[model samples]
Target: MERASRSNMQSILDYTDKDVRELHEQALENLREIGLVNPVDAFKALSAKDSKGRNTTLLEIREIYVSPNVGTEDRELSRIITLYPEITIEGGGQYSQLVLTFENNRFPDMNRIWQILESYGKESAEYRENIDDYPMLQLTILPLTLDGRYGFVMSSPIMWFLTPADPAEEQPRQIRMLIEPGGLQFVQDESYSVEKILEESRKMMASYKMDLQRQLDKEEAEKEMQREMEAEHKRFLESNVTNHTFGYDENTARTAENRRQAWNDMQKDGKFKVGNKRD
Candidate 1:
């Protein structure tokens, strides 16, 4: 008989809108105490506007904490804020706790945003909890409409547990955030039709095929060069051996002829007798 499994499973916490709002506010306050004088003033300086030529408000804020052990300069946080014009600080303290607020309806491409963030430094993934049999959140990078602008949404998956004791009792949920590029607004009227989307897909495939062909051509050229080099090396070795054997054979033939002539000379001088005779 199989032994009973022994495992300790923690209960999942349920996160609500109020909880999220509280956290956001607390994080803002924390940054404010650190050194952020006026977050609103800084945001206004960016002059962020939506499609309707209206000013945008704070849509979301992400808090990034630096390690205490790391000896970072005072300007590092300022540099990070400046690097992303779309982001600003709430308050000032150390580089350890920097609050970044994004403008409303401004969503950037996920890959592009990640690249920019990675350039600044390493970051950790954010997760929230829910209580259900399936995942509470599902994250995806897809096109979406936000505040009258079309952009990409970067989403994260939320897992919900049906039973706290069972490891397999869970479901998936998704939360998404819009990312918009600078100065570009996606109008609903400009949305691609099915035929246009298909055409764009075909063009992308063609471009991909061209790139693949170029790579294959480069590899083939390298292989052909290697083959030529090998063939040349083989020819060189064969030529060297042939020349050495020719010289050796010529020397041996000359030596044998000289020995024959010397024998004939000895016989003519009668120094070496051909037949055995009594003295």
Candidate 2:
């Protein structure tokens, strides 16, 4: 009896070993036979052809036009909305706006003010992932230059929610939170003028906005297509149902129904349109 038990254990181990080995072999074959596909030609070029470590494709992107500064009286400086860089703040909390100010207590030259602003601007951590953090507002440059120093400020309104409760009353609704009198700072440099800096900033801001808009448009189109596919799937499931004697699987029917509903929704939204405009 002991011998028989030992033989059974050995057989189990052998079978397990063979199955694992076969799975590994199959995975390896799949990897080698299926070459990786680069989603973009630029990525492929970067890995296989571009030797200079430069984004040649990205450099070709068109920039937005900058308008000349018509001065302070002509324009109003209102609070613009800016999203926090990270999804959550450092303490596991969420923030709607963060004020980033540049101070100029060091430099005291008037002519070199623009130069200083440009230098500090370059170092500012205004860039957020995917460029849609402040969809409603654009980053603008300030010109307050004096005594060889210049000032640049970034201002944005914040949005957040607060809930209040009274057992007998409804909970407080969401409110728009804002950070007023946004932060500003001064930098010292004489290389560029305040007008030029502001122009550059506006141009950059416009370009970022355009890119974000295009990306959103593309995503919307993809979502519409997915809805259409789901609708078609639902149709198939409903048409292929079995009677009580040969009952259909509830799980399968539910899945197919979901897919079909998605497709139908997409059709109703008119999401699947191929056009030269997209091109």
Leading candidate by TM-score = 2
List candidate 2 segments past 4 Å from native. Answer: 1-149, 152-186, 241-279
Instruction: Mark the regions of model 1 whose C-alpha exceeds 4 Å error after superposition.
Output: 1-190, 241-279
For candidate 1, what's the RMSD? 26.5
lDDT of each: 0.30, 0.31
TM-score of model 1 relative to the true fold?
0.24
**Please, what is the TM-score per model?**
0.24, 0.27
lDDT of 2 by residue, 1-279 (tens): 001111111211222334434433433343345344222221222112112221111101111222344342222322211111111111112322322211121211111222323333442346555442222222332221121112232233333233222345354321222334432222335454423433343455455456546766877898887777567555444664422113335454456555455444544566533332231
Alpha-carbon deviation at 243 in model 2, angstroms? 14
lDDT of 2: 0.31
Among the numbered candidates, top lDDT falls to 2
Give candidate 2's error at residue 225 in angstroms: 1.9
